[model samples]
Target chain A: MNIRQKVSLLLILLSIMLALLPLTANRSFSEKPSKLLAEVLGADVSVTVDEVAEFIVREDPDVRLIDLRPADVFIKEAIPGAVNVPYSEFIRSDPDTWISNREVRTIFYSTGNSEADYALVYARGMGYNNCYIMAGGITEWVRTVLDTKFSGGRITARENALFETRRRAGEMYTEYSSLPDSLKAKFLESKKFSAKKLDGGCE
Target chain B: MKFLRQYPFVLIVFLLMVVLVLFRSFGGNNFRYDAARWAESSVKGSNLLTVDQLSAMTGAVLVLNLGDEADLPGQLRPKTVIMRPESITGKENLRLIRKHRGPVILFSDDASTSARVWMILSEMGMRDVYILRDPGAVAE
Candidate 1:
């Protein structure tokens, strides 16, 4: 066959193969299952609630806390600097929109441990290595950080420092949780705008 | 032969596409289920099995313990296979999971570990796999 005829035949064959294949537009886990599993199971994938509290007290700019509870629940009470990206919404949308900043350590938490762990796995499966979970979730935060007390005992310098961090973090949590709905809404809106700006969006 | 000589570029492109398609089709160890489908099932809570539900299952159930063997409940001891969460996707472990005829349940002392392991296994398209809803129940 001539060059034109041969080229046409090849093009037709390619088109047929493409048409017959069950191609999907959705993204799948790119990393091998074994490698991803090991990474997810690693100790570094989880941060204690105390560490999170310290982050809050320090106002660490490099850390981002993600609350994976419903919007209404999040509005009622959340970690001082946490942004609400409810678990349902988080899994439904592209994670990149929320965790695009690779330089920022994104920590996920829910009322309990399950959702945060699920998000960590999902994020890591999609190759977002910066993602981590707040071990024991918000429940542990309430237990250890918010409920901390001096109890009239002699404290070491290290213990005193930890108590101070927890106290400050708890106070910040209470203050943020106590804000009026209108003010809270405004604060959240501003935070969202800042996050967008950080993500390089003009809007 | 003349067509091959004149249109080598087109032939090369066609061959490359075919090889790529074949490689993607049968060679890679990528996830079988898409992210959306896995997310949907997870949201619906179909991937979780409570302790009560686990106790009710009659058939041969393979319990893959991703925690200490001592932490596993007495009832599950007979059918439990101790496994490390990190090594769950290892060749032998994966082969055993694939060969198991009954439902494979993942158990860990930490609920988060179980949850994370469950997602990884599910995305790999392993069927009839579940995570114990509360790992604490194993201690009970």
Candidate 2:
């Protein structure tokens, strides 16, 4: 065969192979088998609002909150110290950078439960047993921690203690959210992430 | 350039096939867009009650506390009833809900619990069921 004929044959063969690649192995998109779904759903992979609140209040080093909300919402308001990894981005990107530490309790949250539930299931399906969902999402944090109130004549020491804790947490949430734009900007400026330059032995 | 001119059809077909393969492999499912759009618009506040609105409702409002008793707020308005979400299935709580002809406001320590409760009550065909917005911030 002439040079042009040989080149054309190679190109055609390569194109055909590429076109058939997706179909060669299992390719149909479907939810995991029922047993896998059951295992994920039945697992104790949920963290309560109170637990998350305590983590934020105490600034626990071992707890990491992952907000799965959109970037716009996250940029406007998010839990303090929480990182935004929107569900789409989480699904597309490598999670190692965000969730590599086995010791850190990575709690995923969205505006509500469903998105976080999906993220939890996805993570668990990928063998990430250390992942957890923040039950009820950020909305729950607002209602349970911020809007709590005592009423009627009933008063108990334990209840009082709980209320005080909620009160403190609520104040923290309010104080953070109510900060002036300039002050928040300054704080954000201080928190800006600067990439580290790598010094290596590459020659 | 000579090869392209001589084999335009083959080149175009090869490029198209390559593009298709790359897209099928790298382009994520449309499900991502649907899920994101669903999430962005899912938290509807149509049935939400703000502090001012609740205060204005006066006798018509019945606040149901669906969280732990320990975390009750410092001062809840009158006609407030405390009960776990599971307790809602009981005849007593159902009766209390039915007794209130006006709005039955659901609240918890967090918006998440209240939202879940709101969904349950909403699905139960209850009318005038509203969730309490966070008092610290204005209702969105």
Candidate 3:
């Protein structure tokens, strides 16, 4: 073949490879669309602040709390044990690192419901069935679980249990939020800069 | 070989278009959830009413209690309509919502239930829907 023919053949091959990439190499391009509309219409996958607080308190290994806020805002104040996975970084990040396991109840939250909702849908679209959004997000968390104060004389056993949970959760939030700035900074710094170093393997 | 040389550009464009269509059909989450707009609305507190604020509002506000009737506070009974979250469907609920002239507030001992109710109402195009800040705070 002539130089022009060779060039054209190469271009055709390149085009064909590109056409097949989505089905092979770029697997994400083949994900099913989000079922959020149907899910919302049928049922909500919202987790309560109290439930999340309980998870933190119990140190539930099966539960993963993801904060979908900007790093700066997340660093300022966040539910303890929350990993900052800002919305922008979500699409680029690997799903396995945060949400591949169906057993883990991965809950997403933000300053409000929006970011969490967005992350929930994204995770659901990626086929993560255990994903949930923190209802009302941090704002509600602050107002409900953090600032909660039990009152009134009459209460049921169930109500008492709920109150006790809230009281404990509230104390946790206070203690975490009230830590000295230097200590908080050091703690945050310790958790900063995630880099998974892959060790080289030999046969 | 001759055809490839003659129509190289066309072949490339056609392949590219195929790839685009494939991605559109198979690419993740065509249902895009706009977080910015949701954040803006959430920040505005358009659909959220704290328990304290709800108590202060003096009007014929209809509080839709999603909790069991037994769990609902007696003080709220005068203006409360108890309904299960699963039962918040059909035209009957829509008519009940439409009948209320004042703001319709959703309250449940379970915050998740109330949040679901809020979402259902909002999805159904009901206006002025709000959820209580905390289910535990409903009594006060």
Candidate 4:
């Protein structure tokens, strides 16, 4: 075969790969995945209602709040600044439609729990970082967001614990100390690059 | 002549697999679970989208709670919901196959619900329908 044929075949294969690469891409989460994945990543994934509150208050840019419930339910009630993008829509790898700012931190949540978690997995497969799942989803959000007391529905105790942990914190920047020595240098030098959450759907 | 000269079967298999993955992901959660597990392995080392990972992502066996007709949520019509345990009678949920107007996706083990759904939709004079059976059930 000529070089042209080989090149064309190469292009065809390349295009196919590009299309399918993130077919299972996920960016955020609802449930912490199994232990093997959790240990390797060492990232705090569950987005408790209280963390949702903290994320909103501090305006953490590394976080983005996405609601994966159906449009009508989301229209009725959602986290203040959370954006509504039905989970079904993430069938494509494109995050631009759901997320306007690529680098901003994002979180996805739902009343059904795993719906947003599944969506976040698919988002990560799409090659997005800085995404997470709100652990108990909107059910927890309704408890913590409105009351600040973490009451109502089936909100989890672990969620409240995560909130308390953040509250007792000395320096948020200390999280970087856990990073490898090589990456820590870059992280410290670039103080402006620290992670923060985005608006969780406010009017 | 040119088609035969293409860079072997491995490349074709790769391309075909990618398309099927796209189709399955969009279709529903009936596949790709085991494959996603394998792909997840060495995730820190190399993030390759392999066939095993695709299977894991696709192999989703979901059991939706159709509940009883009386308990159906919201403005949804009676015929629209798959099967309601209360509305269905008898022990054979297979009856749901008779009542449903559209394709009946069965997630429940309740036989009475199945039979009732079947009868109602059939009485409504609907066909061209199908039943998405539970993965556990023996094929009829």
Winner by DockQ: 1
On a 0 to 1 TM-score scale, where does candidate 1 land against the true structure?
0.86
State what share of the real interface contacts each candidate retains: 0.75, 0.01, 0.07, 0.04
Residue-by-residue lDDT tens digits, candidate 2, B29-134:
2111112222222244366777777777755668887765543344454567887765564567767886788889887766555654453344334657887777
**Candidate 1 lDDT, B27-110, residue by residue in tens:** 535576457666666777788998889989999899988888777667878999998888877888888998899899988887
Using DockQ as the yardstick, the better of models 2 and 3 is: 3
- lDDT-best of 1 and 2: 1
Q: Give TM-scores for every candidate, taking all chains together and pairing residue i with residue i.
A: 0.86, 0.49, 0.55, 0.37
Per-residue lDDT over B1-140 for candidate 4, one digit per residue giving the tens place of the 0 to 100 score:
45544566546665677678666443221222222232231122132222233224322222223543333223223334443444332334434444333333333344223322322222223332222233123221
Candidate 1, DockQ score (0 to 1): 0.56
lDDT value for model 1: 0.84
For residues A34-125, could you state the per-residue lDDT of candidate 4 as single tens digits? 22233212336555666666776576777768877876665455554566666555433345455546777778787845456445554553
Instruction: Identify the leading candidate in terms of TM-score.
Output: 1
Q: After superposition, how far is residue A56 of candidate 4 from its true place, in Å?
A: 1.7
Residue A79 shift from truth in candidate 4, angstroms: 1.0
Model 1's CAPRI class is medium
Question: Number of clashes in model 4?
Answer: 77
What candidate 4 keeps of the native contacts, as a fraction, is: 0.04
Pick the winner on TM-score between candidates 2 and 4: 2
Clashing pairs in 1: none
Go through the candidates in order and give the clash count of each.
0, 15, 0, 77
A49-132 per-residue lDDT for model 3 (tens digits): 888878877889999888888887876787887787776666445555667668778899988675566466556644677989
Which ranking of candidates, highest DockQ first? 1, 3, 4, 2
